[model samples]
Target chain A: MNFQGIFSMSRKDLTTLVIFSIVVLALPIWLQPFGAAYPDLMQKFAIFGILAIGFNILFGLTGYLSFGHAAFLGVGSYTAVWTFKLFSMNPIPALIFAVILSGLFALLIGYVSLRRSGIYFSILTLAFAQMSYNLAYSVLTPITNGETGLQLEAGDPRVLDSMFVAEEAGLPVSNFFGIEMSGIPGFYFCAIFLILGFFITQRIFASPFGMMLRGIKSNQTRMNYTGFNTRPYTLTAFVISGMYAGLAGGLMAVTDPLAGAERMQWTASGEIVLMTILGGVGTLVGPVIGAWLIKYFENIFSSFNESVLHNLFGFLPDGVEGFVVELTSMFVGEGWHLTLGLVFVLVVTFLPGGMMEGYRRITTLFTGGGGDGDKKAKADDTQTQPAE
Target chain B: MDAIFLQFLNGLDKGGAYALIALGLTLVFGTLGVVNFAHGALFMLGAFCAVTLRKILTMQKVVLDEENLTAWGTPTEIRTTYVETWFGDFGTQLVNYSVPLAILLAIPVMLVVGVVMERGLIKHFYRRPHAEQILVTFGLAIVLQEIIKHYFGANPIPQPMPSNLAGAADIGVMMGMDPNIIVYPWWRLVYFAFSVIVIGAVFAFLQFTTFGMVVRAGMADRETVGLIGIDIDKRFTAMFGLAAVVAGVAGVMYTPLLPPDYHLGMDFLVLTFVVVVVGGMGSLPGAVLAGFMLGILQSFASMTEIKAIIPGIDQIIIYLVAVIILLVRPRGLLGRKGVMES
Candidate 1:
């Protein structure tokens, strides 16, 4: 097989890539109207987008619902931060070590966890993650720094940086060569990785390996009976996704420069799952959309105060306005999680394929495209249920 | 010997709570074949029932005293509970035992909640994929916790035990050992006894009653039971309600041991799942056995001597045991063959 030909995308995929790239690159401008254009939130949009994309590869394709991907993310962040402390503050080496280390971590975890399928697999992953979190919070305090988290400290040995440049003042900040990895630069840095991750996911989705993963998802028992060793394929997907989480973690460190044990908590892992399902499982762009949407809701909706609600409902009569504000307040601000939970339930109940399914339904309604809807139904029918 | 005995006692208390929660989870899984991720939320709701009852029982009436003046140069206010005014010492006693009393309130409320949950949401997903079931139930769990948090706020609400059981028990003296060597909290002991009684009642109910027999048969083969002219669905729904009641009472009784926060359910949810898996999925005895075993192991691992050797063994002991058990015996201690093996 020619490697060059294998790497090339079809015209449609190429078009999708180009359009996705443009839209992501223009997020800072377009998001301004929605009040999400700030650097920190934009960086999160890209970072978590990468995280969700990675998560989708495992759960979306292989149907292995991991509750421990956040462990890899935590590993990546810690590795990157340690690199920043020990070596140069350059993101290149930090990212490289982060991905490699997280990949190895994923390999060990996946090898053990993949022995079981269904909910057992999920439990194994969860156990491993919770252990990591607990250990990080207590016994691993020498490395993780306990509840204080790992952060860059001044007067440390920057073995690599010290070779040429003398120590200049305060705490060192992460950078790409000399480019400060903050503000718009950091968002773009994460965006590049997100785009790269998306492209890789798209290629994998189209590849034979991708088909093998999907086959394992559809019917692993049949695959095993047919003399296919599905373990290797599933393990490979797990590692790749773990590396994606690690990369996202590394990006998070680059943008914020802190690694906390909370990053590895099971709830964080659940959030990753939520993003994938909320967007559209098995679709290339769905995870990214889901990540962006959740982050947007978390940041934007949580920021809405009672005064903001009062202003918005000011057009109504005094009593009516007060009631409206009270009702809306429960779903926004501190209660934004309520809205998130409701949306997640509604999505799973109605749109099992998530937003992409909704999009498909809308298009089918307008264009009278019965074929796509039928294909979707067939796919839904074959979905692997968690074994009872 | 004293340390071991103390850890053993501690383990039994912790194990009782674990066993209670795992029993309900396993029951629902066994009867309905549906993994209810919201089981933990039921437990939380139960704990909040106690909190709500305490709030209601202690509702105070403020009266302005015209003859008295405050530092602010205004009339002083006298506060008295309406319960005290109406019923005197009985009301005070009622407020003192609010935690235990919440069990009565939690039973009916949790039954309705469980039935509604089963019929309205869970029934729709019975034929759907397990992944969808987990997702929807997880979402429901989140919604339930969030609603609780909205009313209760983020801080943990403490529930006081009855004044009679407030102090530590001299277990060492009773066992003919050194004084203060094995003192344990009275409430924890009471909790252990309470759980034992509840577990006994549930077992006897299942073993002796016709309803439980049918439910047990349905668990073994739902289609077969249904074909034999029994409405297994209705029984399963009842079983779900019973499971909720068990979890609710466990939470209600546990408030004196640990304060009830909205997030309490989630924290227990992960551990309870591990316990269930370790106990073997769909096995009631396995869940109970594993719960006690893990609880004891955890308490022992937290002993300074053990921690001295293994360093944070206490933090990860249960998970480590779970991992090892799962790896060594895929079906767990008492797991039957072909249950969730696919």
Candidate 2:
């Protein structure tokens, strides 16, 4: 329970962190030849990664599987859009407003929803999210702009002197501290925010507050009986996580400059849940990997066509060439969703700890690690020593 | 008053769907304790069954007549022959004359599908957490919808009602009103009647049959029932199939009300869940009652006056009611003691 000791990074931990940083930094360069605008996609990946990480704090750590987290995302997006519409096109103000608004919305939803746990909690959140989606889709069209989504307009007065001007007819207006909010700049801006989010999360992970959250997750009744009000700790974690989602949502709006009701849909919420579970629920790197994986598949697999398959199998038999193309095409493009679903099932069934755990197992196998074994032995030694 | 009566009937028709869907959901939830999110998709599949069957039954084969000669000296006659060879003319005639026949066909097909799904996927998730169960079923539902969409295309397919029951029925005249003022569709009336029979049959089966008794016992306590040597898993699987059949029949009957489409399942999923929750998690009677009550409430909420007071009340009334019910009585109307105790 020594805070400083826990917070102090070991040499191996520092080395791993540095390696991860280097990998993240070089990801865009590595992905450039793949026809993906690496920085933009990385930005998106990081944003969703942040969202999933926050979600994991509540779900993976606390065992509260909320089905309404996208509502917070939607709230953030809407808030950012509105800030642009009413106040300024400056990304700073817009994002700040988004985070605040989304946080408030999450606080309200979480307070009510947290009243019930387990299945009831899931149903409560699902109902609320659905209600939010429906209202946003139809009745609140004046605000959400209905199915067409809210977009940046030319007529909107740029009240802030530092706001970015639209470069072209269909360009996004973004002016954050005089830095042009065009393509690369925007991506870098989001990346910086993602790093900030990651840092905050890392700090929390090593903090006593984080320990309290883990304690609450492990045994809430015991924590309460041991003279601690657990509500404040849980609420704090929920709010922090909500803010992360809001920040992600704000970045989404900033990048695309549109806020649609579909963003708030239950499916959207479910996707984040999928990302969290797929990546490694409790691990920092897992959600990021999961988000990147899903997004990569969504963007890449969807674009696959007959020609792509033909190119891959040009060496096949002439008569069977068409069949190969047809078969491959079935598992690619629109059919890629089937593959994604299959992966989800397989992961949940076989790798419940997710891709991070897989990575850990590989590492442990290579290193001949006995970290877990040592901990178990130490516990046994302590028990024997006390008996003696 | 006439409008009210018409709305009431509309409510009943809609309530029939709610009852059927909720009944299915409750059956799965009660026996298996798996919140089958895919139930709506199954219902949608059932409606598609009618559409698929209708297409199959009406398929025409082109035959070339070699004996005939045209004016242009071409010995050709391309006559399209209706494939009435398989089923007699009467059977073909029945396909054209009644939509009710589709319901009969859909039930068995849906039952098989339900059984297959239970055996293939849901049976494994009985011991998993609710979240995983929800996610897996949700994934299955999405897979089902995507498959349906892939095969049927994205657009809603309009399945025509039988010729005899295509137009509005003059139910108003029977109730001492102008026939033109409050005309209900004959197919909808038939649907209502069919739902009644289905509900009655389900209730009767549960009330009077030995299998139903055992299933109920299994639902009340699977452990105790299993300890006594009843195959609870088989019974639960059968119950899942029964639930699927109910939902399928509902969808088949509802084809006239709304066209069948892949996304129709998702459109009704949340609302149906609301009905299930409002009815109580594992309470059958509660589900049926809540379905009817919520259905009527929704219809009433869609009234112009109600809309004027609160826009979008129709869409959200059920959820609001669910929240209120959950807040007031966490166990729902007829919820058992420890169903959601975790």
Number of the top candidate by DockQ? 1
Question: Taking the tens digit of each residue's C-alpha lDDT, what string does model 1 give over A1-388?
Answer: 5988756889899999999999999999999899899999999999999999999999999999998999999999999999999998999999999999999999999999999988889889999999999999999999999999999999778799989677889997888888989999999999999899989999999999999999999999999999999999999999999999999999899988899999999888988999999999999999999999999989989999999999998999999999999888899999989999989888888788888877977787788766677775775674434322
Per-residue lDDT for B1-342 in model 1, tens only? 888989999998889989999999999999988888899999999999999999999999999998999999999999999999999999999999899999999999999999988888887787777788888899999999999999999999988899999999999999898798989999999999998899889888888999999999998888999999999999999999999999999999999999999999999999989999999999999999998888888999999999999999999998888888788887888999978765
| TM-scores computed on chain B for all candidates | 0.98, 0.91
Poorest 10 consecutive residues by lDDT, candidate 2 chain A: A379-388
Screening candidate 2 with a backbone cut-off below 3 angstroms (N, C-alpha, C), the clashing residue pairs are A164-A175
Estimate the TM-score for candidate 1. 0.97
Candidate 2 regions with alpha-carbon error over 4 angstroms: A1-17, A33-37, A162-172, A363-388, B63-81, B84-94, B97-99
**Each model's DockQ score:** 0.58, 0.33
* Isolated chain A TM-score, each model: 0.95, 0.87
